[model samples]
Target: MKKALAVAVAVALTATACGSEEKDDAPQFAERGTFTYAIPADPGELDPANAVLGATNTVLAFAYDTLVHSDADGKIVSGLAEKWQAQADKVTFTLRKGVTCADKSPVTPQTVADSMNYLSDPKNKATLLGVLIPAGMSATADEAAGTVTLATKDPNPFLLESMTAVYVVCGEGLKDRSVLKTKTSGSGPYPLFESVANDHYVFKAREDYAWGADGAKYEPSMPAVVDLKVVKDESTAANMITTGGLNGAQFTGADRKRVEAVPGIRKGSAPDGIGEFFFHQGEGRAAADPAVRKALVQSLDLNELRTIASGGNGEAATHLTSLAPDPCRGDSVTGNLPQSDPAAAATALDGAGWQAGTDGARAKDGKPLKLRIAYQTSAGPGVQAGMEYVAQKWKALGVETELVGSADAKYSDSLFKNGDWDMAWVPLGLSLPTQLVGYLSGPGPDAQGSNFAHIANTTYDDLAAAAAKQVGAAGCGQWTNAEAALVKNVDVVPVVRPTQLVASKGAMVEVIGGVVRPTSIRMLKN
Candidate 1:
């Protein structure tokens, strides 16, 4: 099926660019060549600690080098640190010598220490940092010995994996945290040379970068230059690929067909992690009813929704940890999750005393079954399609769904934080299980403190806290239990898992290895 699709696309492209043979054979790499890419939206922030989305993290992953990094396979690998040792609750890292930032400041143990402290500090905790580090963890640096010690309140099995996000920014980079909101300054292989929000961004390769992984095969003869141009419309991006103007860009199902039709353009999809809508369980209306929440989950038509939302490109998700590797062996909950059944949904609604009215809308007593769902307009094409599909499904279940779309990006804060919306389509990304602690724990955003979901569960909190302390198999089991609890409780519904589509001009772009990291894009020559 995949091969046939590929062939059909090639045939379509042959007709679109009939006289573009010379451009198809153009040299992919030149001494000072620049490759232009089109991003879907303008990155909200450049600070590694602040970035939450994959696109923003892609830029930060190149601009900043973390203490530890994940390889192509998402395995933990040393980045700025050559080696490290863990003793009980303390992990000591041996900093690599002779490393310097883009500003030419030497990277020392003090720099590592300062950066770690800043990230782990409660005052400076951003969404990324909060997801990376455990609660009550601190770091101490020894410049003379070239080592930085991390002290944890409890044993953390996934500490190294967590460090994959602990980007080591220099002291100069820390002069003003807000400045990093728009600008980037780091010691990674790439440096941000120019940035015109939602228009174009340029990244220049670092000539002095010598601290890459031991066996990593990244050697750019030409000073690698990455030019990212924001193209909101996927059709325009696909058009650029055929015109030989863009090296690579993301595409939708419609754009994918158009691009594949172009003779020399290649179409590919990488696992984009999971994408789902989370209900603010602590907010008004639905906050007081668990049966309604369960009914909502049961009412979803997974198969139909996945088809429409993915445009035949994605799969239905069963758990919060979708597409991620199973951390625990011999665990029954690994792939065991409830499927959608309308009969079950009706039963759940009946149990909650919400009977269908003459208008086909469910109601309890005198109140109608109405819900307001808020979604960000800039989340991407797939999300928009997914939201529409979900809203339609909910309507079929005799529920009134008020669909609200926003572009100012303040919808998430206003809806989730202020409890202004009953449900929202929010995509939360985390590489490891430990990274999900904040979102699952009670006292959520709706609560007084850090809870974003506004739903509280003492049982779920206890299981998550205990699981976080365990390492390896034991830890995985506990985490799995916590995940099961969340699913069974219907704290949040798991919808469709999305795959990222990177459309590029095949003649001018050759993505070295099929290494798809959610946080970075390292392209190579043909």
Candidate 2:
């Protein structure tokens, strides 16, 4: 299936490209060249085990190859494995032959199985764990049979779908894992060439690289050497595209004119991605108060948040899994989640015994109603302004807000380290809400994975578990209801699913699933 898809893409691109035009004027097929793009933030962890940031994904995704690959729409297809069959408590896969790791190591059936087992082991403490693979699942290899069997403890409805996230690295890289932090060592399309710390990372295409998924390749002026430069500022990134010094950038929120102002620059966007707040509802916290959570939800305007967050290019988010190839396939969000009304919010707070003072600050028993809001460190000026706008609106409703930021904060530190924060602007995008099991349940703030909200509701937990038992489209309704359950408890404030917009040189590039995948990009005219 993957090869067929690749063939189709190659055919389409081949048919459209001009063969008669001058070689210099047409797309220059360089034997070896470089492609440069600006990265908004530094990927804190390059290794798959500890990587959590989207910034990291952009880099690591190209540097490593997963066992199973998903399409632009999130449909799972074969990568290193050619085929598979599911059994009662395990799934067996036929490994693809001649696959080689970036280190020039052979990727045998046992090698592939061992890599999966490496991540699955409880002792390894891989952060991805159940989020990427089934909880307590292990893979065993049979070399003679040329197959690997993934055995799970119990039924995993989204197991196959979630396996799409697993990126397999070779045994050599796995032994000395510390070196992987600074370099790339996997069977990925682009291998790591050079690293300039937080400034830039340069990658080179392999001469023997023929394992591209679905006919994906960086041929025809795609540039042999790829330079990923770190440019934190969106406005600055836009200028780089215009000047043609930088090839393109992954930018968010209102920078179309700045980019299109340059000739031959093209822009593409995907409206399916989501970015919303996960309010910390720990005990004694003001957000813990159901009334306070409701008021907080009601006071802030979703539409306004959308406008400011995406510079009017985004729409208000409804469900947790808003992205395509999403496990839960419906707009489960309701209109009653929270409507921004200062009057209503004020009334709700006042009735809950918090009275507005002459200074327009709410206080109860000499305790002022203060809320501290935290935003992502990588957020641009517009997003920061949007957060400030929301803060101002909350302040007008007699609530005082304190804004703070952590430098590329980790998932655990953002929740556990800073226990004082009431509401955080932590936006998590998941292809499956089931990917949130550990986040919503489990032990401590650190143990609960990305459950930054610190919610421990038995009702929501049970509902999610029950929904996880159902498979495929049959489970969509249950999953939708499970999301509704979270909304009902006000565990999270679901906001707009912002459209992820990227601007690039119209030298013929395509943006799939809101990303400029290194392999999928090709050139029309240089």
Candidate 3:
């Protein structure tokens, strides 16, 4: 039974959005069923608007609804919004009628407007704000028109595409942000039915679900329940696949090849996304000097790192926006990264006034040129090897590097607290240049801006602002130029786009853009 409810008051929102992939023609099954998969670790948190990890996105996508989505080819498509139209400074979205939350609460158009407001409020501190919505944007609901209009202070050409990543939450969860930490209140085809701490997670399909991405349609074929488990050991996950105990797993390295050896196993992959080291310049840090930043970047052999990290399955990255669904495509990074030249790097450092000691350590005012570099151990062996390789190469250049913590422990800490590391090889993979705007063009450390690398460039800012005025494909060229400007200046380094190879065991499971769309997975023929 669906409740008939309406918000008498029109919702005025601050502004937030994201992009998504659509699955339209989902397969139907003869009988209700269940599906299970395994993972190496638990995705940290489930909140869509708050969490920063992509792991959270990989799992929660099964239970959330974004306003708009992108097709595999990167074209914008309808999601929760039936359709949208853009004008000079605003984009109007017409919500789908009768969509309901997991708690059976009716998700009115007001719910979406409310969601936008919830994420927009500064006190709420939604991590995705600027990445999805332009700074100083707002939203208004036109009840009579059955639409919610979002307007930015300036223009945002990628507004529609950005919405693909901003999942909508109903009023209940929006009202109390804490509730979302332990529970889910979503409007997608499945709800997070149960989660066994560090062990497994389960979701049951919503029988009356209506708004699924293009690959997922509401019908008889939807899996009755989705079961997910965490199998830490790769061998254990592969064994489960062999026995058909689990339908799929996010495989990597040799495990992917092993899964291919299994007759029934299905392999799926998306561009592994891109990776790069962040040379942080927190107050007085060694890398606080751009010459050190440039010298360090130029010192390492990025080509070799790409080879090790991608396991020879990928090529050097040309764009930071490598997500398959990214609407903009261009080569802004080629020939732009600092070339690996030890002599030139040493010369640059020498010119920067770092006197080389007899021990081969560069020092200024008696402090050796020693710095800590942080990397996440959670990244596969290939990435771990790449980080080590980088450290060794930097050491050989006489720039002392202390390979410190796992980013899992220090990512948030480094960003929010008294930063502990001077250099970090943290690479973020995003589909839109808009997403990169915050990290690439914001104010430096004192303001605590999202520019993790402490980059502040008015030129790039102006270029981005100009790109925002034109919508969609028309503005991609300008956005690329803006990003290229950043790359050219070394404000941010764009690295290689790697492949995310996932090996599946069942023939029934359909994979798109390298992921198993839960709603599209049907039972294998007996």
Where does the lowest 10-residue lDDT sum fall in candidate 3? 1-10
Q: Candidate 2 on 1-526: residue-level lDDT in tens? A: 1111112111111010001111224454444556777776677668777554456766776788766666655666777777877554577788778778887788887777777878878787776665666658888899999898888898777666656566777856767778778877788878888888789988888766666665354454566777888887778888878877787775564575667567766556555356567677776677777888888778877777877876666676777764334656666667547677878988999988889999889998898988888765555555587789888988889888888755443422545555657776655556667666665665544453445567777777777777766665557777777777777767777776665545567344444332346665555446
Tens digit of lDDT per residue, candidate 3, span 313-343?
6677787666646777888788777888888
TM-score, cand. 3:
0.84
lDDT for model 3, please. 0.68
Which candidate order results from sorting by TM-score in descending order? 2, 3, 1
What are the models' TM-scores? 0.81, 0.84, 0.84
In candidate 3, residue 32 scores what lDDT?
Answer: 67
Runs off by more than 4 Å, candidate 3:
1-31, 39-47, 101-106, 133-137, 171-181, 232-235, 282-292, 355-359, 364-367, 507-516
Identify the runs in model 1 with alpha carbons over 4 angstroms from their true place: 1-32, 44-49, 122-129, 133-136, 174-184, 214-218, 221-223, 322-338, 380-385, 408-410, 472-474, 506-526
lDDT pick, better of 1 and 3: 3
Q: What would you estimate as the lDDT of candidate 2?
A: 0.66
